[model samples]
Target: MSKKIISVIVALIFILNSIPVFAWTPAESLTSSSVVLMDTVRGQVLFEKNAYKHLSPSVMCKLMTALVTIEKTDLNAKVTISKNAASFNGLNLVVGNQYTVEDLLYAVMLSQGNDAAVALAEYVGDGDIKKFVRYMNTEAKELSLKDTYFVNPTGLYEKAQYTSANDIALLIKAAISNNTFNVIFGARGFGWLNGNNSSILTNQNTLFWSYKGVDGGKLGTNTNPQSFSAVTTASQNDKRLIAVVFNTSKESAFSETAKLFDYGFSKFYTGVLVPKNISQRSIEVDNVKLDLSSKIDVYYTYPVGDSFIKNISFIPNEKLKLPVNTETIAGVLKYTLNDNTVIEVNLYSDKTVSAPEDYRTKIKEIVTENRDLVTIVGILGIIEIILIIKNLIKFMLRAKKTRTQQ
Candidate 1:
């Protein structure tokens, strides 16, 4: 075969043999109800089964209520029980008993008391239950919880009380961010304010005892949906993850969560930032070279399967058309399985920068001009070497002629 034809055939063969990676899918049973396991580092869903499906969050909604309450009120503040606040169909605070906001949180969350939820809400909302409900729904919207709608602070059987597993996960993520809230969630029990009786608020989540590195979370139940969800954080070695599981039978919730947790730890890995102190490099802006790179403490949030090392693909713009500014979000780090189950980690500037007047056009023009200059310089360098060699020969010949004359 001709050399040209042989080269073309080899190139075609290489292209044909390469196959795209496949994504990992969940087993059949897990698909019936929604399930989502995310790596907090990359914020990527490691395994999702009907992740967007809407279902009642049950008492898991308390996680959000607890968060809102924590935001508005101090734990040490005094809570005065009202007629309605103390008298709920399930889990009542004694009609006249006074408690601190912290104690009420334990009752509402650990004891799963609807009355406690109301009492705390009234205290935080300044005796307005409707306004508290408004806060709940508004905050849900702020979190971009598409299918979540809260009718009451307590996750009771209400007409519009519903949330997806994904929505609950977001709520849990927000709650765990607060250090005080984290301590509340993890505690096995709390003391009473009136010195009524020290109630040991055992976590309904059996997984807390069974699972290794299990930080405490919330659990919920209702008749229509025999559901329970908990936000758990577990650690093995130095790697840790926050996992949330929503809407499974009470009998099955703990076991299934264990299964999910085990599946996550066994199938995936959390890695530390490579080269620990390595910072992101800056991109060039118009004429003025500005350093936009951030010192990111990044860890891979994905399952590494059996192989401890995983590949993260950082895809920058093929051409830098986006303006470099502090607020501008550019590029993404995509972590995936051998098969393409993709999750994105964002790249942001560590410091602020101002774009040149003609931002978009200037960026495009600069990239094109820079690339052209580099190519021109590379070619000129080769030509310059050849010219230097010719000049050196001419100088040597002149020196030899002078020697001959001497």
Candidate 2:
């Protein structure tokens, strides 16, 4: 209707569109060929680029080796190094020397030792390296690493021995669940000994020295194909994240990992989405009301927007007996997050649910809980009973008189 008004509206629209809109994404700044940033607790991926693409894991396979060795053998068991294990160029072990599984695992973790990986593999496999590799593959499959395969325990530059960024992230995520693995991975170095053959193994992953909240890390470098990868895990303010990067410089591998971590830390927040012992409902148990509550806290990570929604479904016990205390699980609250993640919090009774009492006992307790009302009702009931008896006696006397007259 007016050309000037339409012109003003057009200018406003253009100005609105011109304003720069920014979203937190890792691709522009991160240079690794493949990368994945994931929330460790939720297993939720924050960012990924070519994460499924097959890339050389290099010495990073030691992460899997350490995990397998721990599962199959005792850490205190002594492992004798063989010629095959000593053949690896890095961290050469004495051919006949014996080292504890724990000390050698330190070599694998901190030194990124091919020799140490092979030794552990041979020891766990009963002198069969391929047998140990099979175990690695089995673990990879079990972890749902669709793009990973292990041909060598040492992570030598074999064309067939390749793993994706996502696989490494997930692999280490599972590996860290074991306390032994977590402890060993976090160590910077150790004075390991094979009898008098003492040597110091220093961790190659720099995150321990550089980053705060850094707990675990694994580093890998390959000269045969010239590739570098790092797996870093850190926790801060109740949030733990895992970052995996491949095909970058040895320096950038750690730096890029830190970048991803900082991004996650700044952009996301994690806390209890559903609090522990929160009352969900109240139900009658044998004429007594009991509050049903969640057993534990359900934590989740999200950005600025509260994007995920929770749906709780209560599954009460089929035969929940009365007189149950707070220890007894009344049921379970199955909280479904976006049709993918399900957190089952066991529901418990807030207080004891007692069995129904006998009438006398019930009255006594009622009187105890409320004396004034109980007294008033008790006196009235006794009076009513006496009045009925008195009326019955008068009627009986009248009947007796009539019979005597007859």
| Candidate 1 lDDT for residue 75 | 90
Q: What would the per-residue lDDT of candidate 1 be over residues 1-406, giving only the tens digit for each residue?
A: 8999999999998887886645433463452366777655545566667777767656656877888889888898878788898677545567766788887788777767788888887877778888888888888888788888888887777767788776776666666778888888887666654455555667776767788877766677665656566656666666555655665566456656666767777777776544222345455545544343333555664455353335677766444543555555555666565435455555655555554556787867776879988778879999999999999999999999999999
Error of 1 at 79 (Å): 0.9
TM-score winner: 2
lDDT of 2 by residue, 1-406 (tens): 6999999999999999999988656877888888998888867777889988888867558888999998888999998889988988767688898889998899888876889988999889888888999999999889998888899988777887788888888887888889999899888789977556677777888898999998888788866668888888899887889998875488888888888888899888777876877898777766677898877777777765665656768788767877789998888777676625677778889887577678998878877999988788889999988998999999999999999999
Evaluated at residue 106, the lDDT of candidate 1 is 80
The candidate that wins on lDDT is: 2
Please give each candidate's TM-score. Answer: 0.67, 0.73
Q: Give the TM-score of candidate 1.
A: 0.67
Candidate 1: regions farther than 4 A off: 1-32, 193-195, 246-248, 272-294, 305-406
Please estimate how well model 1 matches the true structure, expressed as its whole-model Cα lDDT.
0.68
lDDT of 2 at 332: 79
